[model samples]
Target: MTTIDDLPIRDDLRGQTPYGAPQLDVAVRLNTNEHAFAVPQPVIEEMRKRLDAELSDLNRYPDRDAVALRTDLAAYLGHGLGFASVWAANGSNEVQQQLLQAFGGPGRTALGFGPSYSMHPLLAAGTGTRWIGSLRDPDFGLRADAAVAEIHRHDPDLVFLCSPNNPTGTALDPAVIDAVLGAARGMVIVDEAYFEYARSGTRSAISLLPGHPRLVVTRTMSKAFGFAGGRLGYFAADPAVVDAVQLVRLPYHLSALTQAAARAAVAQSAALLATVEQIKVQRDRIVDTFRGRGVQVADSDANFVLFRTADDQKAVWQAFLDRGVLIRDVGLAGWLRVTAGTETETTAFLTAAEEIL
Candidate 1:
């Protein structure tokens, strides 16, 4: 009967918890911020065809650089973004890890605004980089001036800015990104995992990558493209920045099957990505429903909403679970998060919430 204490692990990781949200068995699950829609049938058919084409090559290694996939990703991003400026891996978490591995480690630090994607700090920790939790406005928003001040104060090796931030569901103002890029001495990584679901006018930091070699905008197919199961995440940066991650990433990190499926999905982008608008609609509906009942709901640009539980947060979470709907308790004392699921799923969540409250 050996325990972790007996096995001799890294001193820093001895007591640290792994990053995860609860994956429970429930009828309506809006907990993980995953797109409620599955990949459309046409895209699935396209993938099956592409995968079948790759069967003969399974014995061989995939392209280590994933060049074709990178090319398609570049075309998909389309801000005059080219293949050389993009990088991909299993998921956005791996992309962040590779960035941290390249830029952050022993004696280095990474800073993030609090209540953002929790993984920012955890990823930094896993890479042995110090993590800094900076202050955000009471409403979980980051102002440009304050962000600049914090960057100056910490002067970290890497700064993570999560747009349409998780658990809080708010987008960072472009001004804040500008100020941080101007003031920070290290690389700035903007996590845009929910970019596709943002409001119509939400500006992406991808547009800022031209002259700023240190700025990286990471995105995922998990949310909007309904490719979470496909596990594809990528980032757009200066080609030099893209090259730096290559020095740290595992060789041939993406498999042929993944590349094939993602390429097919991108090819049929219109069909697979058609659900974004509908998800946004459901998101707005959830926000309205909660607010109509006098609950404090955060304005979300992502596919999820964060609402205040105020008192008895755990009890409320349990009540929703008991009713067969699952939501996220983001450890924010008085707040919980629910993803913007499909119309029926959204209605189930609302009805369960109404009954619970």
Candidate 2:
């Protein structure tokens, strides 16, 4: 009989490994860029109440469209970011997949700047689309001239830009984004997963969606909202673009429980905003500590700061782990990305670094 190992896998997935954030039971956990706080008690209590109300319907299928959650999300964006339209999935990762399914597939290409979000290429591979990565300049900023040239050359079906980009935490300029939009021949997806952390003056691309039919801006509750475990993310775009994403998503992708929890989380946005403020404070403190120790740090707009040292990255990571402080290695050779943790955890991390360095 033919065994599973003997079966031919898809060509695109031949050598690809699954992507994941590191898991470690260390004292100061900063590996995955998660928010440094927990969801407030008020939000949790509200979710509990809503869950109690929905307990009877647990046996039934949830709203396939998650209309209530979407309505709440739209209102949240309107108040928070001046965006009026919204579409969601179980998480932003699913939102990414939906966009890829809607705009790219076999023979088509998905273009992104390299070392942004690693998931873009993985998603493209899963969809059988050609993934093209254009490396950013040494400063970790996109070269708009080169990007435009590539857009003119490849004419990709989808292009992804991550603001306050992951790992590096660098925010792209609005003018640069507009230049790409002007040159793009197809859909442009802007991943604003760290929008709240990006204190830069750069505005969300959602504001530009009215004139650009091909633009979509995706946001997540995972970062600033302190709800990574909740797995709720939404996107704002032209209605037509939103409808396209809705078409390809599976029925009941967002559970009734998830919807209830997300609605409660939005209602308590004020508290979440406060927590984000605290994280920012901690982030600045960590950055100062790194700089004081003679480390070179990237200018960050996210909850994390990336610092480069003369020592090898993996060596630094291993050193920290050995000392019970876990930070992301990110495989950038000599650079390390450390997420802001609580006051206690941040202090522990700094002390560990001082000893290790």
Candidate 3:
């Protein structure tokens, strides 16, 4: 068989692994940070109606701009944002990739704090951009001074920040964002994919968009709306930034079915998003359970918890899997991350933890 190494490919990607999680068929799978609920019936009904309406138009390409969908997303984001300030693609990965293509490719560079979203750097490499790896503090906190110092040192063309960040489950201190905006000379991309689950009073970067044209806040329906299968991720930025991404975005990149399904989900947002609070419940339960057991745990503003393992994380992870409860290893030494599933699933994980942790 002709292997990838046998064929000519990008030298930078010769040994690279594609981003993914363990997609195993387990009894209680909580490895990916997906909402544990099925799509709400109301949202499904709305989607079915909208999709049926679009069935006749399947012969043509989707709305190249996805105008109506963008308008609905703007309303959902609501930092006084309008359709011009919003853009969507297959996922936040694609949204960030488009941004990188327009702003950070070739001679330019992109930087993200470590143990942040793993995909940021991968997306950079895919775009021929140099990836600058930075770090959060020892406690996985991104302090303003530390963040600003790193920003000054690299001066990358694009900066990626994740709020209520993945794996670690911590929200960025808004002050760090303020300082980075003051210090960085290029575009700032804040990944707020878990924004809805953020603790109360956790301000969004969206509020800071008015005077800061270079700031972009990317979000997804995947986490909060149980819309991962829907493949809808979007960002809010200055209209000029939207125009820039459009230059790199594939024409009719979003399919008609996607636009219809996602818009329907947004229309039923109130119903679809009630699950956010429910997930938060399970998240806090996980946090409390781990902490009460005297295990070190990160404070979480997202629907997952990161906690230390009693032994090698891989062994502990395997132990959990052996018990029919699968969670995330996240490549963090001595630690593991697990999504907040439904009550029964969370209980199953906790039951496994009793023996494994």
On a 0 to 1 TM-score scale, where does candidate 2 land against the true structure? 0.95
Q: Once model 2 is optimally superposed onto the true structure by TM-score, how far is the C-alpha of residue 159 displaced, in angstroms?
A: 0.8
Q: What is the lDDT ranking, best to worst?
A: 3, 1, 2
Q: Which tens-of-lDDT digit does each residue in 1-357 have in candidate 1?
A: 998888879998998777788887889989999988887788889999999999999999999999999999999999998899999999899999999999999999999998898888889889999999987899888899899899888898899999989878899888889889999999999999998889988999998888899999999988888899999999999999888999999998999999999999889998977889999999999998889899999989999999988578898999899989999988888788999998999999998888876
Please report, as a residue range, the 10-residue window in candidate 3 with the lowest summed lDDT: 35-44
Candidate 2 structure lDDT: 0.84
Task: Return the clash pairs for model 2, or none.
Answer: none
lDDT of 2 by residue, 23-124 (tens): 878778898888888877887899899989889989999988877787888887773432335788878999999999989999899999867888889888
Tell me the lDDT of model 1 at 31.
94
Off by over 4 Å in 2: 1-5, 79-84
lDDT tens per residue, model 3, 200-319? 899999999989999999999898889999999999999999999999999999999999999999999999888788899999999988889999999899989999987999999999
Number of the top lDDT candidate: 3
Q: Give the TM-score of each candidate.
A: 0.98, 0.95, 0.99
With candidate 1 superimposed using the best TM-score fit, by how many Å does residue 256's alpha carbon deviate from the native?
A: 0.8
**Which is the better candidate, 1 or 2, if ranked by TM-score?**
1
Q: Candidate 3 has what TM-score? A: 0.99
Candidate 1, RMSD to the unseen true structure: 0.9
